[model samples]
Target chain A: MTVSIIRFGGSNCDRDAERALEHLGIDAEIVWHEDGLPEETSGIVLPGGFSYGDYLRAGAMAARSPIMADVREAAAAGTPVLGVCNGAQIGCESGLTEGAFTTNESARFQCEHVYLRVERDDTPWTAAYDEGDVIEIPIAHGEGRYEIDDERLAELEDEDRVLFRYCDENGDTGPDVNPNGSKHNIAGVLGDRETVAVLMPHPERVTLPDVGPTDGQGVLRGFEAAENGA
Target chain B: MTAYTATVTVRLKHGVLDPEAETTQQALERLGFELEDLRSADRFEIDIEAESAESAHERASEMAERLLANPTIHDYDVEVDER
Candidate 1:
């Protein structure tokens, strides 16, 4: 029962995710994209980096990789999948999740700590935190802004698929607080099921105590919860 | 088989915000140029050999649908010509 982190051609965060999971006492391994999911895989993480050098667009190439079809099938079978930063873009691009993470509103690569308000607590990803709990995570990407047709965006919101939104330290959300021009300050979202989530923030960056913040521990802990049938 | 060059142009759908284009427009304005607005598109020229120009067009259209453009925010057109 190990979490398999898919390492694409340019995935730089696979090691980070592996260490983060290990620090939580969860068994995890970095699997190359071509090798396919291991038989013992119990969870998946699409860690972040400039896959394919951001050619065409961020996550566009890797989304079409041969392995994603298997990933989709596993997710459908109730395997918990978490995508962070560039992983968020790939999730959307591959249809593992909804919407797209396009260029930032500022049109520049922005890297900083941002506050995320947990939109729900029942899902495996957010079960460790109370609803509206503010957690700090570091986001580093140029194409981190989320985009979807207005009609779909509204429908997604109505369905409560949104998992996290950028907010101030106090958990108040507004355009001013949105790090990127994500619709309604959206920073993370769920798939049709709560077990699958994609967010444009690096939970691994904050999971280690050697680092400054520890707010991201819950997101990584989600793997254990999902495996335990939470 | 006929040799063809398929031109696929992908552009952001109208009304979708494109900050890269906006930033480029701002840069042009800073350069003392006058323009009402600006938009951008990516044109991919694919060379392929197929049974006919129609087949070439079809292949390029599929490519655009699958990789060249994201339907969520992009609209694309494909044109094929004998090379």
Candidate 2:
């Protein structure tokens, strides 16, 4: 029943994820990608980092690693998988989700706290927040812009797969509040199953109460929700 | 078996925003180069032994499809030549 946080080469957030899960009382471990996933893995976190030095595009190399096949099998079996930042890139690159996280509009790395409005509370990742509720989380990346064709974006919206969108403190979503020029201000999305999710913001970064605002604690609690079959 | 070299060129699809290319274009313009537009691409050369050039091309195309290029935002082309 432990969450396995896969740590690929250059993955700096693996330890942070481990500590955050521990702080939440969720059993977790930092599993090296070469070591493979543990048999008891009930949940997975593809922690953020510049895997493979962001070579050939962010998450491109790590997404094609042999272990990702195992992760896909587990996700298909209904195990929860959460990808953050570069992990989000891997999720999309590996087809765990749709769309692409491309270069920022400014073509530069950005590190700042941003507001995200809960688009849906029915999923485990957002069970702690109500639809339309706002949460603060930090985003740090050079290629975090969400891109998809208008037609497909509409389909994803129709399917209600969008989980979060960049917004102002008052929950108003618009281009003015978009930090990286993400299409439609999307900040997070669900995979084929809601249990499989990815987001650009670093929830684990804010999960510790000692750090600052703990608005991200709810996002990290999704692991517990999945364990309880929520 | 014949030895062939397959070249794969991967580029951003038309209409997709390419900030890196834009940045490079701006730099080039600042260097006094007149260009209506500029684009960037990644090229990979693979040498392989195959039954024919067509077979080599097929294999390299598969490589491009599987890893060398991301179809979501990239368009790729493969060319093969006997080495």
Candidate 3:
């Protein structure tokens, strides 16, 4: 399968994401943000970076880019689309998902290794992991805190749209353990199943066992499972 | 003919803390002035020449809801003064 990785003007992780996909045995290419979406691609990934220098609100300008129209259309067509960090913010800004506003508790840039408990394993991106499994991922961003109203929060919980919850070393979601003070300790969420996934953490950064976390295999395996129809 | 002044106040909603406002308030407190509550909000004044005060108020309210405040996190009140 081929994965089209979209690269904006300021995207920093495009190569890393492409590498990860390549290592996973999938053909991947970097597609420019201004160019039209690549056809005949099985999956699309919006890599993380400071798009438009994070001006006028994070991901706000990139959300309105010319290529986002095709991205939205691909997402609506049930194609697997994954957004990482600023990409996640763009996804929310583009109305690909529900509310993902500014941080609620601590409004500051945070960078650290965070534990995340898998809330659902049915999505294409998380199918390799069992429900309730905890994994470590790196998070680095200022606007990573997810905020929503009580009603919508409850609805997300009930719908199992919450894909991952931040936790501590012991994998317990709590105030002190939460890294970015995201509402519900959310780390990732799926829009309309696994077809559209957005996560604050950078899985691509942790995919190499020699360079990054050892748990990278599991995360990549998750995507590989989806490719294999597991 | 009637003249009306419309005032719009934009501020963070309750439970949503503004770090910039907090720092400003702390600075004010350091100046040794006893203040019960130091909250910061943006104020906009627009003078409109309308047929009636009610028309001005309606127009100001619409502006407040549409642009002055982000309904997701802020609530705005508009006051019109008839002259």
Candidate 4:
């Protein structure tokens, strides 16, 4: 199956994402944001980077790009879509999900290996992990905080929409453990169970064992499973 | 033809802190401004050919709500003066 990785003007993770997909033996193509997404691709990935130089808000300008319309269309058609870092910000700004705004409590950019507990394993992005399993990934962003209303947070919890939660190096969830000060320590969330996924951490950056986190293989495997209908 | 000055106070809603205003207030205090109340506001002057001041005020109010202010987090007041 083919995976479409969208590359905006400032996207730096396109090559990383492509490499990860190639390592998993999945045919991946990097589609420019100005150009439309590939029609036959089974999955779409919005890789991380400072799109539009983070002007007028982190993903505000990129969200209004030409490719996002196609991305929204594909998502509505049940095509699995994954957004990482700035991509996650764009997803929220494009109205793909609610309350994806602003910066961390510290109001500064942070980059480090963060432990994330898999809260939902049924989604296309996390199907390889067991519920509550912790994995390590790198996150780099200024506005990585997951913000939502209390009522929506409750709904997300009730629906099991939260896909990952931040934890400490020892995999313990707590106030100081969450690296970016995200609301409820949420690192990632699944839209409509599996159709769309948005995460703050860089799974692509970690997918290679030679360079990054070993646990990143599990995330790539999860997408493979979805492609293979497993 | 008549022109009126409308003062629009676009302040954050309740429970929403205005960092910009707070910073400005601190700067004012440092500048030896002993004013107890220092609230910042924006003003816009609009020129319109209207039948009455009341009608002009109504039009200005509509414009403020529709575009000048984001009602979700800000409230604006429009004042129209007869020229």
Error (Å) of candidate 1 at residue A31 is: 0.6
For each candidate, the DockQ is: 0.88, 0.76, 0.18, 0.15
Worst 10 residues of 4 chain B by lDDT: B11-20
Whole-model Cα lDDT of every candidate shown, in order: 0.93, 0.95, 0.77, 0.76
Ranking by DockQ: 1, 2, 3, 4
Against the true structure, what is each candidate's TM-score? 0.98, 0.98, 0.80, 0.77
lDDT of 2 at A149: 83
| Model 4 / residue B12 / CA error / Å | 6.9
How do the residues A1-230 of candidate 1 rate in per-residue lDDT, one tens digit apiece? 89999999999999999999999999999999999888888999999999999899999999999889888999999999999998999999999888999999999899999999999998888889999899999999999989999999999999999999999999999999988899999999999788999999999999999978889999999998897777
Tens digit of lDDT per residue, candidate 3, span A1-230? 67888999899989988888787677889998777887877778888999999764577778888898998888887677888998888887777876664553455677878888988877777776788888888888878877767888899889889988988766788888877767888888878656788988988888766686755455555555666665
Where model 1 places Cα greater than 4 Å from the true spot, the runs are none
Displacement of residue B45 (Cα, Å) in model 4 is: 12
lDDT of 2 by residue, A3-92 (tens): 999999999999999999999999999999999989999999999999999999899999999999999999999999999999999999
lDDT of 2 at A13: 94
| Model 2 error, position B34 (Å) | 2.4
Against the native chain B, each candidate's TM-score is: 0.96, 0.97, 0.84, 0.76
Instruction: State how far residue A123 of model 3 sits from its true place (Å).
Output: 1.3
Task: Give residue A30's lDDT in candidate 4 (0 to 100).
Answer: 95
Off by over 4 Å in 2: none
Compared with the true structure, what per-residue lDDT tens digits does model 4 show for residues A41-68? 7888888898989874578778878888
